[model samples]
Target: MQIVSTLRGLMLGLGISLAGAAAPAQAEMLDLEKDELKFGFIKLTDMAPLAIAYEKGYFEDEGLFVTLEPQANWKVLLDGVITGQLDGAHMLAGQPLAATIGFGTQAHIITPFSMDLNGNGITVSNEVWEMMKSHIPHENGKPVHPIKADALKPVIEKFRAEGKPFNMGMVFPVSTHNYELRYWLAAGGIHPGFYSEDNITGQIQAEALLSVTPPPQMPATLEAGTISGYCVGEPWNQQAVFKGIGVPVITDFEIWKNNPEKVFGITKEFADQYPNTTLAITKALIRAAKWLDENDNANRREAVEILARSQYVGADAEVIANSMTGTFEYEKGDKRAVPDFNVFYRYYATYPYLSDAVWYLTQMRRWGQITEHKSDDWYLDVAREVYRPDIYLEAARLVVEDGNAAEADFPWESDGFRAPQREFIDGITFDGRQPNAYLELFPIGLKGSQKIAQNAVVGG
Candidate 1:
């Protein structure tokens, strides 16, 4: 718990004068359908927006009284949201998509807000790090950054020859970590396993086995040697470096620049029934995000202290600041400037872009979480159903009018897609509109009606 006096004062008065102006902007906050709400989040640094909204009284200013609870894991958090036990929760970008498609749990979950971007990293234990050091290229005595998983292929091969299972961990079955880790490994010619309808271990044809381990437990699990590596969000990756157990080899930012990571999810039933409440929540979150990235992240120090509160992230302020405040520590003390490592508001981050939704669906399909092949229109339809950018713009309009955000800060006229993205570490371009085409681009995963039949890939 590291909240300081200056941070407390800053939290109390954040954009107070603008609250009056913001109130008149739109239909976001009405005579409120529901004012008392409970939201759940995992204790990761990206959950800062939720904490900031509560501490800065942003939710209260929007005529909402909110309770923020930390959940046990991704499943429990999603269950709470689906069961109406929670109004909403911080979620993996794929949870709403996966749950809605009946991949895991069947629910009509929707997100008006995409939380933060590129807040995750892939960490390798010291033993694994030592194994990879010789294979990685170096510049001026420091290992070259954006270290590809190609460097780890030999290490996995060694484990394979020795008949040892090279275990790795990810936060969830549908987490961005799972996808990002898979993407990195596959790009380097290492098979990262697959998911099948009958066999859901996702270790089919894996060179290195990946399974779920909660983010907070990652450092300890790596230290105990149960998992040789993991892909997870901050400050857990930073925790590994600080505890001297592991070294983060690559961040999601390098794996895929500015990748969409997490979202703020609520059931579609909740949104339709209480549209105004959804708008209000979105607005408070938008304001909090702006505060986070404004003025070149000038407020990040204050945010770090606030997130270190006992009930919030609960990690040391120093560890959280490692990635949250414009830099990331890889091998302990081998820090580098990674300004967008934990993007919150910038780059239209909060918008629930349909392209972002489509991208998640592609990963689900590529890995066989989606058991059948569907048309591009099906992907587009799901994107439209799950991502509500229309509602996000309504909230953004209020933020802009309230003197908090600029008009140019949002993608006001986007047709729910981004241009073909080509920043992946594999150098593969992803166009959200061409999902099947995206699947075909993969070298080592299910594609085009492919199914895992009898523990093997059957169709193409």
Candidate 2:
């Protein structure tokens, strides 16, 4: 009778141990400075991390009740973040830097986490695609991908000969799309224009004139023939292919592999005043990003369904699934496998590296939006001011301690820069430490003591 009683106790102890091992560790919920919070996002598929966090209970796990609102446009979203109407928003990687530099609206904003990577594509209208088909190389009856703007050059020339302005659209003046489109166009011997203080049109000395159009309107605008082609985020790009109006010729992932995209931006004043709340929000976002990419994107199909809801992306589940499910559709019926098209956590996508900030600043300078020659150290200083890796690592540490994230997942020893990157479409290498020297590699853009004056590049 004594032996039987002892065996029963041992069995109970073993069961409890097994259950504890299987359960995920929960981090101690911080005392949030302000528990109920409001966040904003543009209606795009890359905003999935925000939606997933709210839906999958990551935000609730951190004892945060977050209200995710969709703003009308990027400008309104940035303004909301600035005016404290919104706690923080999903922001363009350039919005904070541009705001600090006083490009449009002057406000000091900072980002603690990068939202995702490589979720944009460049699409051209059907007429433009038809015109360029002969110029592009064909493989297995499909157009050769990473389609250079060189293929569209003759179309522009024909328009120029016929006295028609060749206009293309980008989401904003200081956007990754603007820079990537310019890079791809310039690489293919087409000028996508420049920005000058005197002329904010960004059409100085250009073969293809570029202008601004909001993301959701990209497809309708292209269909209406307001612009020939546009560069924007998904599933708008996929929306075009679905509507049979435009063809996505190239994705930003092909242009620049693993390029950083959106960010979770907040005011520095907000961070300083409510540090604990900031950490809590970042922790929830980090966990959401991990779930988006966990088990090799096992959760993406579910994510696509959530993002398809009206309050989030509001696009069809099928359209969102195209890129969200590790495949991308270029031309209609030309779906191809692109596994890294929407990277959330893999490759340290959430870590807001200072070097990534420097790259955007350099693009601003290269395109004359900065309007002054900034020193390399100036670039680093601005980067450190806006990109807060310290806050990110702190939040990451909390996640790690909870056993929710692996220690090897975060870059603990990084000096906040990736090694020099050389996978550009033009085959030029960019070292963040030498912003000016890196700018000089581009044959087309302004570099070193150069400024735009009177609708022309002057004083290099």
Candidate 3:
């Protein structure tokens, strides 16, 4: 791969004169504040950018000797970063925000890089799927795509009639899976519940109860009847299909098209102390992200192999490839083309957009994880504090200077927010600039000055 990169660099150098383009400037190696670094990630395929950066020599190219450690779970991963055990980790988009605002653990965490987009799916056990099949529409004897949470609504009601709680699993409270699962459920008129100051279980006034389960444990937990369904990142969702234990009813892509997923999170203290190291790390990750999506994902098969190794995601290559290589499996033998299922780059996936940060904050507020109503300016300020687009754009500039990426490949002129997105499953447009108004659009969840008090929503 290094040889190929060198050859490609040489060819580009030769082509510059022929094409009458000015020669690309060589990027100077950053003066190291820290050279040897350790990063952590949960065992999910969205961690691919970190793994690819390490495996493809992008980290070494930036003079970084990186150790990519697989963490036990999201909390352990976040704690590792906060305590300086790991420099950073692939994090849930809301982790840094929740931490900064003192939700669970109070620490000032920040992310300069957004890892990937739309890499999660909500899966239900075989029993639950069998029950839901009748409610779901079909075409050509297969269930229609983007199967809404309405299909699960009747099933949850049935469970209620049977005097049982309809339990579901998400990776963490602040995880994209949690918000995506809740969003999908609420869109179909099933309340996934809320989190209050006293009750952090996030099951207040709920139809389906959501709890944290580690990503790798999702399939087993579902099979054990501990959770009827789960929302998690690959290859666990694909793993369930491989084991015939569950069916993935929907991908987060269908819930919110191209929604921002994971971010590479580090403490503010670390970034402040090792500014050059932060830029260097971001540059390498940017290159890795570009490679993952380059040539229409021509390198995905290779990426699957790397992720399937024991030290990485450790799932079967075929299972990892089920979604990583531009398709996703919903039910057994129901494989379909979903080209954007796991986006590492393209669509500015790596840029830490403030709007993306604001979207997560909105979800945090909607779900009661945030106890008080915050103004729109508060949302923007929190996003600015946590999502460092300045660092990300600087790294992008350096990567472009190094001839490792095209200037066109980045949102160099972006104002750090995406244009208001409207591709949600429920058809509600999200204007990040007006978060409170967006909150008002939701039927379920906290809005305005509403707060969960004594087991009910009040003060709206």
The best candidate in terms of lDDT: 3
Worst 10 residues of 2 by lDDT: 1-10
Q: Each prediction's TM-score against the native? A: 0.94, 0.94, 0.94
Would you give me the overall lDDT of model 2?
Answer: 0.89
Q: What is the overall TM-score of model 2 with all chains considered together?
A: 0.94
| Model 3 residue 74 lDDT score | 89
Worst 10 residues of 1 by lDDT: 1-10
Cα lDDT for residue 271, candidate 3: 94
Clashes of each: 0, 0, 0
RMSD of 2: 8.3
The residue ranges of model 1 lying beyond 4 angstroms of the native Cα positions read 1-29
Question: Comparing 1 and 3 by lDDT, which wins?
Answer: 3
Candidate 2 on 1-460: residue-level lDDT in tens? 0001132245466775322221245755676688668899989998988988888777767766678889988999999999999999999999999998889999999999999999999999999999999999998899887788889999999999999999899998888899989989999989877888878888889899999999999999999999999999999999999999999999999899899999999999999989999998999899999999999999999999998888888899999999999999988999999999999999999999898999999988888898888889999999999999999999999989987899999999998999999888878888889999999988898998889888778886
Model 3 ranges with Cα > 4 A deviation: 1-26
What is the C-alpha local distance difference test score of each model? 0.90, 0.89, 0.90
Identify the runs in model 2 with alpha carbons over 4 angstroms from their true place.
1-25
Model 3 has an lDDT value of 0.90
lDDT tens string, model 1, 295-380? 99999999999988878889999999999999999998799999999999999999889999999898888888888899999999
